[model samples]
Target: MDYWKSKVLPKMRLIFVKAGGKKAAAAAELVKSFDESKGEINSEFEEKKADLQPKVVEIYESVTAPVKVLIKERKKVSAIKKNSAAITKLFEDLANIEFPGAKQVSEGISKVGPALLSSPIFATFEKIAKLLPVVVEETPKEAPAATEEKKDEAAAAEEKKEEAADEEKKEEAVEDKKEEAPAAAEEAAPAATAAAEPAAEETSAAPAPEAEPEAAAPAEAESAPATAEETPKAA
Candidate 1:
């Protein structure tokens, strides 16, 4: 029996036993805490379980109860408040009081529901109105007056635009005149010089052909004297 137990049993135990690991000590501690042989569970783990159970039960009850019915009732009350005429009438009937009408204002609210719902300002006001039982007044809003000052401002803007256009046109005309002035001066210069040439020639004296013949006769007289003097010497 010793030979079988020492040789076969130890080998059999090695075969059955899981491979020991880095986590074996932690796993053994966990096993010891759970084992009835060690006694009841650790006090800290039991206390944590007790703390979590009530929260778990609360969550379970909330998920299982009539959540849909509560949501539906809240929506119906909201709708009743939205239809203010109906609520007003309900209040009037129940309390048996003769108050001012709320039907027209209620109709206005209904007609402008989409506008009111889209506006944060109107939506917040509407929520406040729903909470309170005050009657909504439909006071008429006056159209803004067309003051003389506003009309004058519009006319002034138009006049300023016209003045700007006129100034632009005047600037263009001045530029065109500046460009044309040089061209006009170039064309007039030759005509002015040609006209001056004729005037200068007419005013100045040009020697006549008759005056040249007269001047040559005087030279003829002076040479005769010299000729006479030479002849005497030759004789």
Candidate 2:
């Protein structure tokens, strides 16, 4: 594990190298034992890692994205110290994932994890990385806050589109009414002129007063003509 490598192993090297006689012999024996067991350790580590990869990837995907942000901003002191409940959950989950000699590594974290700020976070990840497929940098998924902002923007744009569409409809209606006003007046003008033409034609085509007297005389003459004609008709 990374903790073993970074902390315990160095101390081991220092102590073994510093001492002489029995200590040097014991260190040699220990190295031989590790070498003999290396094959088994590696095989077990690999198997456990394969099993844990699924859960690790799941955690990486589901951890509220703060974990990724923390890892991405690990270099910054402020960012590194950002305490995320998701990261705490990550530590808890990592503690549960077993590997070859996993206890030896997580022992430090279990003791110091709750009170610790940042280093153990990285250290926990480092161990997980060795034992699981941790995708520290995949795609940066948007947080709920960011997702809501996007939704708001989309809704605003949709509202604007609806407003624009409504305005266009109103303008079209106004334009249609304007056009109809002129068309209706044009229709009415012809109808009014046609009605007036018949009246004017009747007035202008009326019989004259002179013609009326002549038409009356013929009727009167016909009525008197029978008496004068009767005298001559008797012979």
Candidate 3:
């Protein structure tokens, strides 16, 4: 058992942890892809899980069974001691092993599993199995809604831009009409002045006719003397 703990269990823990880390990394990558693709991770996620789950589970069970056996037989195999004493005894027992790389394995187990019955790694794995799937399922649901909201905002902005452009065109048309009004009035002023000039000239010529009649009366008066002389000749 000491040899197994120092040699086989440590290697098994490495394999188990590595598989778990790979699964975690793959899941994280899938989630990132899901966000980029607007919530489209279902197929890829299932494929990756299918490929990785069996291997992870196999290694997990292999490592977990031994660790659980050790934990169950801890009191019978060795007397319970303080955490520090247990770690020290475990290292001392490892030193007796004559394997090629026994020292390194011993050191690794000491670092990873100081207390075999109460290993933190075991608890952590349990938590991962329970919680990771929940996170994977629920995290992607918000992505589509967020994407739709961004699309709506973009459409609203485009509509506002179009409306602003139309308003600018209307204002330009109004300004053009305002500018044409003065030019039209200026063109009509000359024609109006020409039409009134004839009426003004007729009013000024009326007094000249009166003066002509008065001059004709003086000529008639001078002709009366000539008429008297002619009457005497006839007699």
Q: Which candidate is the best by TM-score?
A: 3
- Runs off by more than 4 Å, candidate 1: 1-127, 130-143, 146-150, 200-205, 208-235
Q: In model 3, which runs have C-alpha deviations exceeding 4 angstroms?
A: 1-138, 207-235
Better of 2 and 3 by lDDT: 2
At residue 1, what lDDT does model 3 achieve?
A: 89
Error of 2 at 25 (Å): 31
Ranking of models by TM-score:
3, 2, 1
Question: Could you tell me which 10 consecutive residues in candidate 2 have the lowest summed lDDT?
Answer: 108-117
Give the alpha carbon lDDT tens digit for every residue of 129-225 in model 2. 5543445643556576688999999999999999999999999999999999999999999999999999999999998666777799989999898
- List TM-scores for all candidates, in order: 0.30, 0.30, 0.34
Query: What lDDT tens digits, residue by residue, belong to model 3 across residues 1-235?
Result: 8999899999999999998776556545543432454323234334455454444444334444434344334433233233445444433442443212223334534543333323322222332243222226546789999999999999999999999999999999999999999999999999899989998999887764457778988899989988988999999
Superposing all C-alpha atoms, what RMSD in Å does each candidate have to the true structure? Answer: 25.8, 15.4, 19.4
lDDT of 2 at 75: 50
Candidate 1 lDDT tens digits, 83-165? 54433333233122211122222333344331222222122223223333334555334223346668889999999999999
Candidate 2: where are CA atoms >4 Å away? 1-37, 40-142, 198-235
Report the lDDT of model 3 for residue 141: 81
Candidate 1 accuracy as lDDT: 0.46
